[model samples]
Structures are given as structure tokens and as C-alpha cells.
Target: MNYTLLNSIIVIYVGLIAYLGYLGYKHTNSTKDYLVAGGEINPFIMALSYGAAFISTSAIIGFGGAAGAFGMGLLWLTFFTIFVGIFIAFVFFGKRTRQMGQNLEATTFPDLLGKRYDSNLIRAFSSLIIFVFMPLYAGAVLIGAARFLETGLGISYITALIVFTAIITVYVTTGGLKGVMYADAFQGSIMFLGMAFLIIYTYVQLGGFTNAHVLLTDMVHLVPAKLQAIGHQGWTSMPKFGSALWWVVISTLVLGVGIGTLAQPQLAVKFMTVKSNKSLNRATLIGGIFIFSMTGVAFVVGALSNAYFFKNFGKTALEMVGGNFDKVIPLFIKTCMPEWFAYIFMLTLIAAAISTLSSLFHVMGASIGKDLYESMITKDNRGSQKQSMFLIRTGIVAGILLSLLLGYILPISIIARATAMFFGIAAATFLPMFMLGIYWKGVTRIGAISGMFTGALSSIFWLVFIHKKEAVALGISQAIFGKPFLIETFPWMVVDPIIVALPLSLAVTIAVSFFTGNTAIQPPHLKKCFEGIG
Candidate 1:
């Protein structure tokens, strides 16, 4: 509608990002700088980068849409985002991870585990998992941003995806960790401002906060019959406890991403980007505030969007989005917000997508270059440092291509489910090893490997064969089992893989460690992982 002003804002945003990328490229001279910013990142930058990387377009566009469909009950995830994702992650996990990563000279999440246990197989396996599965998560982020451009600005979806991917790949491929984090910090600021204004303005538009929520509560009778059959209650309240929608929202969306955030390889590696514990301690406040505003406002606004749409258009947000939940926020912004605010918020969405995409590509590249290929070459005494960096750069390109392909092919309304799937898989595969490796001296290499394999494999199996999203989408269960899903039981069809996979992984690790008779070889470097221990 207002092309001139929108174009100017975009140009300025792009220029600022390019300048940050230049600074990153200038500072990044060696492999160490490329991979971990030489372990000397500013505390403020690290905190902002961590928060930005963690809450991407997937959270704002994807999960926000989910909130619009499912209701304000999604606020439980906000609580978890603050307490678990920020506070506990920084205080408990971040401190130990940084200390151990520094002690072990580890540059990646998989490298930390492999070095901690002195097992090359563990490192390579975990890295391979990242190289393969991370694209699904990256694709979700790509789709979220791309969909916004397509829906809000009338850009071609293919053009949006390619352009977004191209810009991010350039900065990430050149500037490395420094470039990624610097850009992330700037983008995070934009996102924080955009979401803050969004929530405040939304409330003002729909009367006061209390009146808006009360109106929403009164619209429970307007819910679709199909949704009610599946347990959706009201926009202002939770679904029936233990109902199908309840299980999907709680077990899949909430627990999947909430608890799963602890083991995120991309985010975990951020702990090692800084120099000391004080940086992490300082980060806690920044990270907490960022996550709270980002997620809290998103959920509140998303749920309120339904009310806004219903009142204005006499139709639900879901109906307006044409069954594609991911389009709800973009549609809201395009139709409701002032033209200038719409342009500014467009930059915010782009920032969110680019920040997360940069981190994902970096992690994917390092996993392949430093962990998989480099580990093999070093094991055979044939690895050159230059060759390792080349391999990682190659991996970054490959990862981006795969994600672009997935973004093109994935079905509509898949952003939230796809995001959950990645987080759940990461939690199942890596959480046990990461948590125990940091705190428990008795954790054996064999135990960790077994848990890792079991967790990863079982999660994939369940997703492919049992989870409703994949099964129904692929038509595999319908073909094989004469049903939309393989598991016909209640809650099973709705339950996320993490609920089953994570516990089995934890149990297997503990059992294997106990049965194998605490013959753990605690090397000096490994012992340094735990402070005040022999």
C-alpha cells in the first residue's frame, strides 16, 4: 500500500545488517573466531543472540498462530520459556557447559559430549543427527518468514524464501559466529520493540485488556464443532484436561519445546561463546526479559487476534487465514495495523528469521566440518585445518539448500508442529547426555552412546510411524493400518514423541551406567567438568 516508506525502512535495515556482518568478518580471522567468536563475546551480545536465536519467526509467526487457534493456555509455554529456557539454562546449564567446554577446548555441542567422554563415535553420531534433522527446524523458520512476506506484502513465496535464505547465508557463510551473533543482537532489539508495540496496540484497538479478554471468554460458543469435538474450549482458557487437543497443546507444543530448549545444540553452543561465568550471570537477566516479552506478548496477542477478527469481520481468525494457522499474525498486521507500523513490523519478522537462520546454519556447518569430517580426518591423521574450514563452509550451503527444499514442500499450517518435532527430537537425543555429562561423574561413555542412539532412533520411528502429523501427512498409517494414525488409542495419537522418547532415553542411560559397573574412566579434563570434585 505504501511502497516508498516500506522500501526505505527495508533498505536501512539491510544496510545496518550488512555493517554488522562486515564487523564480524573483520574480527573473524581464524577457525576459533569462526566457530565460537574466540570465546570472548560481549555478555550483552551473547544474551541477546541467545534469546534471538531461540525465539525466531517460528515462535512469533508459527506458535503465535497456534495460540490464536488453541487459546491463551499457550501462556504456560511463556512460564517455561522464562524459568527453564532462560533462568535454569543460564544458571545451571550455561555455567557448567561454559566451564566444561573451555576446559575441553570444545567448539560445538557434539564436540563437548565427544570430548567429555573421549568417544569419537559419540561426536560423529550426534553431529550427523544435527546435519540431517536440523533442516526441518530451519525450514519452519524459513516458512514462517516467507509466509509473512507472501501474505502481508504480496511477495511470491518462492522469491521470499530464496531471498531470505540468500541474505542470511551470505552473512553466515562469511562472518561466522561473530557475524551471526552481532546480527542476532541487532535483530533481537527490533523484535523486542515490534512485539511490545504489537501487544499494546492490539489491546488498545480491542478496548481495554480486561474488556477484550472478557469478550473473548464470551465467544466460546462460536467455536467450530470439529474443534469442540477435539476438546477446544475457549480462547481465554485451557482445553479440557487430558483431552486430545489438551494433550497436543501440552505434551507436544508445551513440553516439546519448553523442556527441549535445554538441549538445543545451537543454543547450547552459545554458552561457550562467552569468556566467563559472569557473562552468563549477566546474560540471565537479559535473556529472561527478552524471552518473556517475546513469547508472552506473542501468546496474548495471538489469542486476542481471534476476538479482533470476529468482532470486525464477523469471522474467526482461523476462518480468515483459510485453515492455515501460520498466516494469522501476518493477516492481522497487514489488515489492522497502521501502514508505518506494518512496515516496521515486517523488518521485525525478517530480523527474527535471519537471526535464527544464521545460528542454525552455523551450527549445521560446524557439526559437519568440525565434528563429522574433521573427526574422521583427525582420527586418521589426515585432517588439515584449512580443509576442515572448507568442509564446514560446504556444509552450510548444503544445509541451506535442504531447508529451502523442505520449506517449499511442507504443508500449510505446519510451522508449529514442525518446530515441535525438531525440539522434541533434540531433547530426546541429546538432553540426557548433556544434563548428566555436566553433573554426574558416573555417566559412562557407553551409557551416553546408548542413550543417544536410543533416543534419536525411537523419536524418528515414532514420528514416522506413530505421530499423527507425519502419519496423516504421509498417508502411511492409513495405507498400512487403515487409519489416519498407527496408534488408535486416545492421547497416543495426540501425544508428542518426546513424552515417550525422552524418558526411555533417560532410563536406558541410567540403567546401562548402573549395570556396566561404574568403571568410568574419569580423565583430568573430564574431572574438571565438575567443580569442587576430586
Candidate 2:
């Protein structure tokens, strides 16, 4: 591969995103415009922006790495993403979210929930959680993309990180949500197309899908002895039931991401960017198709990479990637694809990274400015558009710096786990509150607060005190619980914080609402939310 050409393509790609950001800056005139694109984004851009944010470097590099380590069993995640994350999300949550957001005139996730409950505390606290926890997710995404560049293009990790982060931050800070959405639509298309091409090319290079599978199966004994001891036989096949690897794949990777999608603040906010239920409906097919191709191809190619490596290097794909796990797909592309295709794939990877990063940064800024700064810190400051925009850009810079620092210090081995931890926390804390607050009138501020607190704390506690890696890192003994948290007893996985916290939050909200006699006044705007939507 000509290094100069690769560098040139990257520079050109980033230049286009900057140009889009400049256009967005021209259109941004108010606080609402900065935060939610003035709620005028088209359904197609909304759909692609949602997809791009959802399918990040974490999904492609991190999950593909998991597939390399765990086998095709992780494919269940791809299925859940289409059926649960997209199909159900669009049909059930999308329209109501848009309607309610518009009714309340909200610009961020925290603002939506806070206004729905008439509680500034809810808004401020939720903003704090997002600002604090989002960096871990952001850092993980940064690491995944940077690792790919380091492995595939022989670039320094620091250089890759800085370049990728700078480009995303520039557009996000300048153009806000509108710029991010436009760039996401373009980048998302590249990701979808690149993944499809990579899958087809990988199959062809391995002598078709059937031959690839057979070769993968023939090398079953090549599975790492440690993995074999835990029942993993090969990269192409599923792990044996009731094994450690099986549990990790089922409980953590599949459920973590699938359930986590519903609560992702960045993705959920996209549902509010468009105007009507019809817009959300139109976006459903686009989002579903995008996810199916993007995630589906990543898992399929990840599994098949075993064949590529086994044939060429006499070792498994994971071995070739130096146990970094995230490098498997990038390495496969570098070794198997033509130089030109590799160049295209590099653009796709960068596009995936930058698109997701931009959205994350935008959501974080909105959370701070609209939810906390305006509502709580300056409760009497009378919502001035200029002041709000100033706070938002300030938050954007602060967020980027924090994420960069965390990415530098966090251990690479647990980056995937860290990413999963964030998703799990979101699922536990926000999913129940959002779902019930919209559908169930009995959801009081007290109940919503209780649920968010319980879910967020319990999930973090389990990850830190009970997870093997965290336990070891913190010098805590896991034997205190007799096994890893959620790995013991029936319904544990189902009762994991997300499951427990959500229902508990709902139950508390209902019980408390009834006990308190539904005393709080419901805003007239709340009723208007459902009007004209059915």
C-alpha cells in the first residue's frame, strides 16, 4: 500500500467533513439549532445518523474482535441489533420520543426526561452521569479505531488518535448536531458499503463461504488451549454450552449491546431530531438495513478471518493480532485485500470512528449546556440562545479533553469490558425511566430518580467489585460472592441490574405514584405530545 495515498485519502475525507460543518455553522442560528439541528433534520439523515452513532468503532473493531475470540455465537448480537435495537426502537419508542421532545421543547435526553417529570434535579443529575460516564465509552471507541490504524497502516497509535479526535472535534464544536448528522449520513454510507464489499471479498479470497467454513472447522484443534479448556473448539463454530466462554458471549457481549442500545443517550436523542411520526416511520427501514449490513458483515468477516490467517500464517487470527483482539479485522483486511481496497477500508474505518465520535461529543455538549447549565446552574438566567450556545461549545472542548486523557490511561486489555460497562449502566439507568415515563402516567419523579440511581449504582458495583478484571485491578476478592456477579444462579442474567433496576424503577414509580395520590400537576404540554401522532 502506498502510504502517501492512504494519507491523502484520510486528509480529503476529513476536509469534506469540515466543509459540511462549515455549512452547518451557516444554518445554526439558535441554541436549538446547535443542540438538535432545530428539529428540522430529514428522516433519511436522522436514520443514518442514528445508525452511524450506534455502529461505531466499538461495534466493528471491538465486537469483531470478540467474534474472533468467541466464535460465531456472537452473531446473535447482530440479530438482536436489527430486531430489537432498530425495529422495536423505531416502532415503539421513536415517535413518542419525537412528540414528547417537541412538546417540551427539549434539546437533549436529560432535558426530555427532566421536562417530562417537571424536575430540574432529574435533568442536572442525569447530565452529570452522562458527562462523567460517557468518556469511558468514548475512550473505548478511540482505542478501537486507533488500534486498527496502528495495525493496518503502520501508523503510531498516538498520531492516529490525535488526528481522528481533532477532525471530529473541529466539526462537532463548530457545526454542532446538524454538522455531525450530515457527516454521519455520508460516513455511514461508506461504512455500510465497505463492510459489504469486505465480506464478499473475504469469502472469495478464502475460496467461497463453504470452503472457508470447512477450513475453519478443519483447524478446530488450533483453538487456544486455555479456550479449549473452557470449551471453545474453533473460530467458526459455537462454544460448548455452560462454559465460561459461552457465558461471557451470552451474558456480556450479546445482551450487553442488544439491551444497551435502547438506553444509549446518543442514539435515543436521534428519535427527537425529526418532526413527525411519519418521519420516524420512514427512518425505520433505512436504520434496519444499515445495521443489518454493517454489523452482520463485521461478525461474518470476523469469523472467516480465521481461515485467512490459518492458510497464510499457520496460526489463528487472534494469534496474529498479538492478543490485542481489536486488530483482527484490520489485520485480515491488510493481508487479504488489494492495496486499493485497503485504502477504501481505511476510509471506512475512519468514517466509522469519526461519525460516532462526533455524535457522542454533540450529545455530551447538549447534556451539559441544555440540561445542567441552563436548567440548574442558571435556573434564573432566562434561556438566552447565545449564552446557551456558548456553554455548549465550552462543554464540547471539555468533553474531548477528558475522553482523550482517559483513552491514554485505560488499559487496552479491558477496553471492551469498559465499553460494555457503560452500555450496561445506560440500559439499567435510562431505559426503564424513558420507557415508563412516556407510556406510564404513574411514573413520578421520585420513582424515576430511584430507578436511575439504583440501576446506575448496582451496574457499576457489579462491574467493579464482581467482574474478574475489575476485581483483580482493585485487589478485591471475587470469592466473596462465590463466583463472578451475574454468573451465579437462575435469573441472575435476567435480574442483572438492567432487568432489576428497570422493573424496580417502574414498580416504585407506580407504587409511589399511587401512594402519593398522583399529586403532581401534569403539564398541558405533556398531553399535547400524543396529539397528532397516532
Best by lDDT: 1
Candidate 2 positional error at 398, Å: 1.3
lDDT of each: 0.90, 0.80
Runs with alpha carbons beyond 4 Å of true place in candidate 1: 379-383, 478-484, 519-525, 528-534
RMSD of each: 1.6, 2.8
TM-scores of all candidate predictions against the true structure: 0.97, 0.93
TM-score of 2: 0.93
Any idea what lDDT model 2 has?
0.80
Worst 10 residues of 1 by lDDT: 525-534
Name every residue pair that clashes in candidate 1.
Answer: none
